[model samples]
Target: MNIDFEINIYHEDYHNAGSASSEIKKYLTQLGLNPKFIRKIVISSYEAEMNIVIHSLGGKLKLDIIGNHIILTSIDKGPGIRDIKMALTEGFSTASKKVREMGFGAGMGLPNMKKNSDKFEIKSSPKGTIVRLSWVIE
Candidate 1:
């Protein structure tokens, strides 16, 4: 089965950042995915969502669930990441002071997403950024 969802990206909104992931989790649970797989998907989704909110000007997330595989695609209209290598490093952050004040600028988002997802791809340009993440159920 294939499932898809669209999520809005709102800047600096922690309260709404994880909403997409939450919906994804609910659907995965309903589909009887393993707890570990579900957890990983949730974490990765949350991280990607936050990246959209913090880094991008604005964008949307598309989650695709196909049988035993889960794929998450995050598309944003903000400035693309100039240094993908540095951005993936642990403890590296570019979040603004206002975002940091919310206690979300520890810089673990990309690292955590990479750690949890089986496959990760990032495409970025001066115009925007697109992140794709996937994992197997088994």
Candidate 2:
């Protein structure tokens, strides 16, 4: 079975940050994905969504579910990552003070997403940023 979804991003919208992930989780549950896989997908998707909301002015999230695998793509039109290596680290952040005050700027988003996904790739430039995360269910 295959499933696909897309979500819009808005600036400073923490309230709607996890909406896309929630929709994806609902779809995965209806499709009968195992509990463990569903949790992994939800966590990774939420991380990706939060990154877009915190780092970018606006963007979109795309999800593709293929059989036992889930693929998530997050694209943003922001300042882009200056250092992919540093961004992937566990405790590096470029978030603003306001974002930090919200208790969400610990910089664990990318690292946690990578940890939960079977495959992760990040591409960024002055133009924008694109992140792809994939997980395989047993």
Candidate 3:
């Protein structure tokens, strides 16, 4: 079966922080995905979602399920990361002081997403950023 869905994310919208990821988790659970795999997907999705909310001007979270693999894409139009390498580093963040004081932006988003996914790719330019994540069903 092939499944595809998309969710819109708005910048600095803390009111709906984890909603997209939570919905994805529910869908995956209903699809009978492996528990561990579902957990990883949830984490990855949450991170991606939060990134859009905190940094980007706006973006979309796209999810595609094909056969034994699940694909996640976060496409955002923002200032973009000047240094992708540094952005992926743990304990590195560009969030504002307000965002930090809220107990978010510990710099763990990208790293954790990469760690939990089987495949990860990121591209950024002055115009925007795109993050693609893939995980294989076990």
Candidate 4:
């Protein structure tokens, strides 16, 4: 069976920062997913959600459970990343000072997301950005 879930994220929505991941965590738990796999998915989802809040105008996060793999896709609307390579680097962020003051922009979001996923891909342009992450269950 295949399952899919989607959540909308608004820019700078600190109030709902981790809600997407939290809800997904509950869903995975109810499905009896392995703890380690669920942890990775939750961590990556939180990072993606934060990225949308910190960077884009808004976005939607889609999670799909197909067979033994979980797929996550985040698509956001404008102001896109100027440098995809740099954005993936640790300690490199374009978040404003105000965002930094809130202790949310350490530039670790993308790196952490990639690190937690078995497979990761990112694409960006002047229009928007899209991030895809997938993990397999063993």
- 14: Cα error in model 2, Å: 1.7
Candidates in order, TM-scores: namely: 0.93, 0.94, 0.97, 0.96
**Better candidate by lDDT, 2 or 4:** 4
Sorting all predicted structures by TM-score, with the top scorer first, yields 3, 4, 2, 1
List candidate 3 stretches off by more than 4 Å.
Answer: none
Give the higher-TM-score candidate: 3 or 4.
3
In order, the Cα lDDT scores of the candidates are: 0.86, 0.87, 0.94, 0.91
Compose the digit string of candidate 2's lDDT tens values, residues 22-106: 9888887987868897898789888888988888878999988788777899999977999999999999998889889999889
TM-score of 3: 0.97
Question: Poorest 10 consecutive residues of model 1 by lDDT?
Answer: 9-18
Give the range where candidate 2 is weakest over 10 consecutive residues by summed lDDT.
3-12
Q: What is the lDDT for 91 in model 1? A: 94
Q: Give me the runs in candidate 4 sitting further than 4 Å from their true place.
A: none
Candidate 4 local lDDT, 10-119, one digit each (tens): 99889988999899999999999889888988989999999998889999899998998889999999788998899889999898899999997899999999999999
lDDT of each residue in 59-126, candidate 1, tens digit only: 98898878877789999996899899999999999988888998888989989989999999998998
Q: What TM-score should be assigned to candidate 1? A: 0.93
